[model samples]
Target: MGGSSLRRLNARLVTVGVLLVLAWGGIGYRLVVVQALEADVYADHGLDQRLQREILAADRGTIFDRDGRELAVTVDSVTFYANPSEIEDPTTVARLLAPLLHQNMLDVLDAISGEGTFAYVARQLERDDADRVIAARLPGIYYFTEPKRVYPMGELTGHVIGFVQADDNQGLEGLEYQYDDSLSGVPGELLVERDPHGRTIPQGEYQVVPAEPGSDLVLTIKTEIQFAAAEALQRAIDRTGAKGGSIVVVDPATGEILAMVNLPTFDPNDRSDADPAAFRNRAVTDVFEPGSTQKVITISAALEAGIADPDTIFEIPTTIERGETVFRDSTTHPSELTVTGIVAHSSNLGTITLGEMLGAKELHRNLYAFGLGQPSGVDFPGEASGLLRPSEEWCAVNCVASTSIGYGVSVTTLQMAMVYATVANDGVWVQPHLVKEIVDGKGTRVAVEPLQRRVIDAATALSMRLMLEEVVSGGTGGYAAVAGYRVGGKTGTTEKYLIDEQRYSEDDVVASFIGMGPIDEPRVVVAVVLDSPRQDDSGGKGAAPVFAEVALAALHQLGVPPDDR
Candidate 1:
């Protein structure tokens, strides 16, 4: 009996020992698989929970006028953000931020209570307001310094300087859009470790790639002259009840634009509510029939081609008939006039007679050479290449006649100013430019060189200048006379063309005047164009006065002494 019982007990004990050993082996294998084979996977999972990477914004560049006046600048601003997961009470946080940010409480609450890990409470806050938020010491609330673009001159240079988008700080228009790459600096990055509560762990896993700043632009604009031109243009528009207007002042010798101003402008600092039309750099973007201003080109072409001289006689009837079209002067005039008289009076019929002598090919060539039917080469966005049909397109007699008197052609104010600048510069057409220099982040300065080419002979330019002088002295542009300066310019009054109707509006007209002063040695060329002035107003009475006011102010600002004084 003892032997059988002992044998059974020993067999059971052996079975239990074998089962225990197998279980221990399984446990050991499981430990090895988890600790050695999948160590990297678990470590990465932990890092994903504790580490955060953030982008740092780089500072934008500044824009300055020729006299070092700051037109556009970047300033330090703060952006408020919240960790929704870490926020203990979204309602309390929203209530605290509502008044400071000028946001509705409900909106703030929704943002803070969102499902996202992070949410922006406010962006680009003023320093004082951001400091107040920090002093409140609200948990889960933080702020980071960011760069903000601002225009100090407000609406003075709004069109030219343009503005940046509020959401991403990207350029939207004008020089800002054209030179965005140079103005936008390289962004930076930061890596940091955080705790479960979303607080940065001190001195833990920190790395930063520093940001690089952008280059500064120095413009050719003169601030005082720009102000004067803007004020004069605004006054003209208000006085005449015109829709809008533009003024451009250029240095003839250098072809550097001194001032470019357009009315109905907006403040770049706060442009979100501005009309889209106010954002356009109208002097370069908008075009109109140049009216009698085109006569300067015609007369210059005739004189240059040797087809006519200043005294070339023409029997200019008050009304000229060509097939189905009939052209008439602004007013009834005598039958005969010299080329000089024709240009000074801005006679449409007389200008057509000159065009007949030069023919379409010669006329088109001269207009093209004067920078007509082309972009003004300004460093601006959406610059227009004005409409000028090719010489071959001038098939009809009306086409030839209309082209001569600025009817079949359109030009930007900048182009017309450059045309007169060409004459003032003695027939050498220097391409106009706005930027004067670029200052890099490392403090390196680079000067911008302008493009130049010959368009008309110096002798022809002199004759043209003398003829234009007659215009301001006693002809159509009499109101453009600047006291103590020898003024020379032409007036243009043209019926506005309706694009949809494809016909000229009898009641609406564009009044413009282009002039250069101190004719003996011209220094500045000014162009003024008023859109759709009252019917009683014409180029001589409307735009010519504006031209005089701006030209005199510009000449004075440039320190050019009066020639007649």
Candidate 2:
């Protein structure tokens, strides 16, 4: 009986020991699978949950005036971001950060209440202000350094230097938009480990690829000249009661835009209430009938064709009937005047007579040669190739008379300026450009070489220059005379064409004067256009004085000595 009891107890003990061994074996196998077989997969999953990738914005390139003055620059600014999913009680967090960020509490709440992991709280805060927000120690809120675009010259260079987007610093208008890619550099990458509360994990998976800076642009714009032109234009607008205006100063020899000013300008630094309409560089973008300022081209073309010399005489009637339109000069002239007198007095019939001799195709060819009816091919964006219809498209009845007298055509201020500039440059039309050179981060410099083409013979250009001198010295452009220099120019006054109504406004006119200085050795060419002048509506009274002021300032700035009287 004792042996049987012992055997049964031993069997029970053996059963319990076997079950314990099996359980231990299963536990050990499971541990091996988790720690060795699939260890890499589980480890990677845990790391991804803590890992963060960030973009390191590249430093935008600097914009410099011809004399190395900074126009546009990038400065250190703060951009605040948040981990919305990690934020506990978004309403409370928003209330704490709202006042510091200068944002409405509700707006802040909406920004932080998102279920997404990332959100922007505010952008582009000054460093001192950003530090104050950091001191608050709010959970889920984070900050990073972003570059802010600043125009130091303010509204003075705003039209030409242009402004950028607030958040990304992307170029939006003017030169900023024109050269965006060259200005925006390559961005870098950042990898870091962060805790769920938006705090960077110390000594955990930090990496960085430093960003490269963008190339810099050196412009041909002279600051002193730009300021003078702007001031003079503003005064013209005030005196003439004109809505707006544009002034362009160029170096005819090099086609360098010395100073380009457009009114209704704005401060690029603070664009809180800026009108988008004012963003256009009107000197390059807007077009108008050049009126008699185009006479320079017409007279130059006639001389180039050898159809009429400056001394050639023509029957200059006060009114000449052509088709239904009786073409007439704005001011009465002698019944018969020399070619020079016709140009000096700006006679419509006299120029039409020359146009008849030159013929339509020859006239069109000459106008095209003088840089009309085509884009000036300036480095500037949106340059209007003044509207010139093909000779075949010209209505046989009135196109010749109207076009010869600066009507039935359109031209940009810059385009017409270059016409006089062409004559000033010895009949050579050099491609216009604002930028002088581009400098890369490596210190390599590339100069912008403008294209040049001969529009007329040097002799013809010289003859036209002398004739234009008469216009300023004794004729219609007398008001454009500079105080100490021998200047030559033409007056232009055209009825303003209303785009919406598709007709010329009876009351408003575009008054313009384009001129060059030191006639024998031309240096500067200035073009002024005043729009919709309520008073002093003629180019002689409205736009010529602007030319005088800008030309004198430019000549003095260039150190061009006054011509011996």
Candidate 3:
């Protein structure tokens, strides 16, 4: 209506037009960014929401015995998993899977009940069962191919080969754990584009990066010898009413273990209810006082130091005292005995006298050189170094005397077997090992070259072998003699040390016998250890018989000629 008002309205309209132009410019800039400049990045981001990356499992290796028999192996297996949150009806799904999975419906229901995204309904299922689960097509239940470790020998080689985890197939114990890296090859990845409901989209982006398979292991275990040892040990347990036992057989010249078995073993196939204690390989992991079986080391030490020979004479007192401890021979013997006679009789005073000649430091050094006081450098996992304190610590009280008589020192069955193996191998100490070779997926071969060192001179070893022969022929180890073979060995029985109580058990004892057969060219060394036998409890009676059984079988299996003629 007024001239001033008309001018104001035109100015407002111009301002509005400028505002619209700026808004359009900003919109064009945004459109260019979304359509062209960052288009690839945005497209990738959107696709990422649908893309799923999955870990592809590698195939585990196989374990073979010396004879190429499959001791442990892996096969294709199926595992069914579920996302409880995604499950439409847990009860119905559980019901469908229970019978096929061989699991209780209630247990399955509980596993699939929670809001968690993942739960294992059943692991390591067979193809038939897995196929049945697939046919059910229960929502939220997912499955993919996974490996399952199996032991063909069952409890026969349980403690040695060990087992792996069911789902991830990770090594859990024994040689499997020892060489996990070599056995577990590189894993791969799989990319899959999925829809909103977690379905694989049709014609969606999919790619697979292949997994490299693991290496295979070949052990030194002779199946025949292993079976013989296992059977003998089991019979020994039954006859003696013993808690358990262990047997170790080795090739004296090569340091390769032939047979290693432990009782109280569990099946590695399915360890759902297996006691963890059954997993221990006692020959390598546990230790015990060696008793008279250790006399060889002392005698060999004396011979090595030129302090005594097999015929060297010592006057043995009936009872000898060091500090408050008084030591006596297990059985009555003459007042004086030559070194050979002393070993045969297992004279405590005689051994102590010889130990005084070598002293503690030299003895400890020799023992360490023999692979005691340290791990045997075995290829198996969880090997113990055994208990050998520093030599300087032994000068106090009757430590030296106790050690000489095999009361203070402790050793594993494998260690003791290796000790006798040294004497059998012309006084050379070699690192004992179970794995003979490992072949990888790349066709690379890994052969075992065991460590070797001379523990004693060849002459001393000859003398020690002769002295041990006398033990089996006329002494406490009479039961350890192998038929048609000139065998040599030592017997040991010691009070069981109770670690939990920090004391020795008055009643329980560890009975053991370690021996080698075909004495002139000793081929086999076997160590038998029985735990807490009530009847036939002494080493000579309980463990020696087992040693004979195993040694004979091993010798025969190796096609060794008998020297009885």
Candidate 4:
């Protein structure tokens, strides 16, 4: 009995030992898998009282103007945050911070007494203000370095250089949107170890990868020219009691936009109180009936096709009927007026007759050649291609006749400027551009150049120039005169159409002027648009004066020598 009992007890002891070892091995394997293969899944967070890791955000980039002037820049600031769960006395802390932040005490207390471990107390506070808040010793409140964008020139080029939003660092409009890719850089990261007090330990192990700030953009706009154009256009708008106004100045040689502005422009600094319309860049964005400014196309086409010469006589009377539509001159016309006279007088009857001789297809070719019915490709967002019904949609005689006289269609002021610029540039269609250069995050620059494409013959351009000269000297655009320069341009006072969501018909008016000057060797092309001008007869009176005033100012500012030739 003794031998059997001893053997059984020894065996039982060995089996128990083996079972314990197997259990220990199984637990060790499970722990290894959980910690190594699935560490991120299981250990994703830090507990309420334990120290944890946090991130330090990198600095954002800055923006500068063409002349290396600070248009927009980021300044170092602080963002205040609170650990609501750590605050001992929420009411006391709120009372101290509410006045410092100018926030409601109740709101502050609510933020501090919440169940969350962290919440924003204040963001983008200046250094001085942040220091004051830090000195107050408010419980559970802390701050870190932040970047805020500031505009040095206020609203000077606000329309061109758009504003950034609160959360998003990229541009929302204008050249900002146009060149956002080059301007926006990748954000950097920082791994910071925090203690129980929610403060970073200076000696703690930290992993920091410095941030690369965004690139800088240099635009073609001249600040002084921009300011001058804005002031002059604004003055005209005020004097005429117009609802709104727009002006664009372009280098006729290269098609570089020097100044483009729309009245009621906003200040990018404080955008909260600005009207939505103030953000719109009307020169390239807003479309309207071009009226007589479009007559240049007809004359150019006629001259190009040799359908009629300037001296060719047409017995243009008053009104002429085509199908159901009756086209008439602004004033009664004589029985006989030369082709040049019809252009000078802006005779609707005469224009329609000439346009008809060119035919619809030929007329459309001329308009398309002039850069109509497509995006101007300017460096700005939200630019419209404008409304141009295909020639296939033309309703026989009525549509063709109206199209001839600059009706039944819409175009942007930028497009109108291009027509004059093309003539001034001897018929070369250069793509309009705003950005002159792009500077990368590493301070490297890539320059831009003019994209030239010829659209008409040199002979046609010269002939058209002479006709436009007639417009400024003896025709509707006479008011846009420079005393010493060989000024030439056109006037357009189109009836603003009343429309529903589907259709439109004429009732109101949008007065505008398109011109180029020192015609002997043209340098600049400018166009001014006054929407719904009050107390003016036509574009000749409402818009021509504005164009002349701006052109004169621009010439004087640029020190462009007067043409004594």
TM-score of each: 0.88, 0.89, 0.87, 0.83
Per-residue CA lDDT of model 1 for 1-565, tens digit only, reads 6999999999999988888888888888877877888888887888878889978777788999999999988888899988889899989888988887889999989888888789998888878878888898888888888778889999999988888887677899888888888888898998989998989999888899987887899999999999999999888988998999999999999989999999889999876698987888889999999988988998898888888899988888767889988787776556898888888778888888888888999999999999998887888888899999899978765788889888889899999999999999999999898889988889999998889999999999999999999998879889999988998999998889999999999889999999998887899999999999883379999999998999899989989898865
Local distance difference test scores for all models: 0.89, 0.89, 0.90, 0.81
lDDT of 3 by residue, 193-264 (tens): 999999999899999999998999999999999999999999999999999999999999999999999999
Q: CA lDDT of 6 in candidate 4?
A: 93
lDDT tens digits, residues 26-139, model 2? 888888988999899989998998998888888888999999999999999888999998898998999899999988999999999987899999888889899999999899
Ranking by TM-score: 2, 1, 3, 4
Best TM-score goes to which candidate? Answer: 2
**Could you tell me which residue pairs clash in candidate 4?**
496-508
Ranking by lDDT: 3, 2, 1, 4
* lDDT of each residue in 466-502, candidate 4, tens digit only: 8788888888888898776787888898888665544
lDDT score for residue 543 of model 4 = 91
* Steric clashes per prediction: 0, 0, 0, 1
Deviation of model 1 at 258, angstroms:
1.6
Model 4: per-residue Cα lDDT at residue 469? 83
Model 3 stretches with alpha carbons more than 4 Å out:
1-38, 46-54, 82-96, 113-118, 135-142, 190-209
